[model samples]
Target: MGAEGKTPRMTSHDAAGRSDDSDHRGYLDGQLLIAMPVMGDPRFERSVIYLCAHSSEGAMGIIVNRPAGSIDFPELLVQLDIIQKADQIKLPENAESMKVLKGGPVETGRGFVLHSSDFFIQDATLKIDEGICLTATVDILKAIAKGAGPKHAILALGYAGWAPGQLETEIQDNGWLHCDADPDLIFGGDVEEKYLRALRKIGIDPGMLSNEAGHA
Candidate 1:
């Protein structure tokens, strides 16, 4: 059900940002935020994200499968100054081309990698969990340039972050539905149906969803 709070403001700057989305708080880390089928918010409709961090203060997640419009994989590498061979840019065989995704509306120039924790950025890597890891350092980019990165990976140009209590309020208000995230859902699935599919993963039929949430 929607919370007793108001919709949080979308701020422009990081430091200047403040949030009111939290009337409640907690993390659904490693969980999936599946967009409700009736959602009309352009930013989140039909989106599926993996919650990486959460607390009473705020939350952050990575949108795994939404490709940034008109932007292909190899083109993203070149934009990031990573050179790829013409013969290998779109190699016919097996190679996950360097690509970019529309992570969120927050930052348009930043990049983040959401991959299995089985791959680490050396020893000092910040591990999210036993199954997932996030490496933002340019070294990881360099590793990707050399094709030495993780087995399954998604490159997001931006991210989705909510302020303290913001995410909680949304959940309480039912802005998003929760489900256990699947690797296939995040890395190799059709994003067009990902939200609905994720809901199904948890046995929640999308047809049962209603835009107006209520506490019974």
Candidate 2:
């Protein structure tokens, strides 16, 4: 579904509004969704999504794999005017190596930072899990430019979302397989191996996985 604008900032309340609702059972918040081969949507084919919030209302997540091609973090800083071009080389090691990811198909123009919880802004950060948080403001970009941001972070240019019962139906139809999330799976630098790794983590060998549609 479509959001309001290009840069819609999601607060903790917005992300986890129905989190405590008793009817919001079996939600997959803070988990990983691995797309099965039978998935009908090409955008999510072979995708590995990190569920940030899940409740009776809906679900939101970011694809941890799928690098945003040729998008350099330092150059993005310059483009956003967060830092001058001359200061590119002065960026921290973490900033220099930060990977820019295509989070999903929706709101592709916006940037969302899925980061470690070490850094936070009073009302801008949405803590998805113990060590993971999501911040969608440019203020975090400034912090990164100054080397004062989270220990680990990735810039995702959009996010995946599902209406109430949509994700559950997909799971029931064997469109996805879910498993627990870890820092390595979410923040690891190897963008290409996440899908296969996630399958293996759930004890399913990729080679043996079939395109059959059945319960996950």
Clashes of 2: 0
Q: What TM-score should be assigned to candidate 1?
A: 0.77
Q: After superposition, how far is residue 141 of candidate 1 from its true place, in Å?
A: 2.8
Please identify model 2 stretches exceeding 4 Å from their true place.
1-24, 214-216
What C-alpha lDDT do the candidate models reach, one value each? 0.64, 0.83
Model 1, residue 56: displacement in angstroms? 2.6
Residues 142-197, model 2: lDDT tens digits: 89888999999998888999998899998888899899887898999998998999
Q: Give the TM-score of candidate 2.
A: 0.90
Instruction: Give per-residue CA lDDT, model 1, range 45-124, as digits (tens).
Output: 77888887776757889886577766555555554555555634443211345445777877656667777776675543
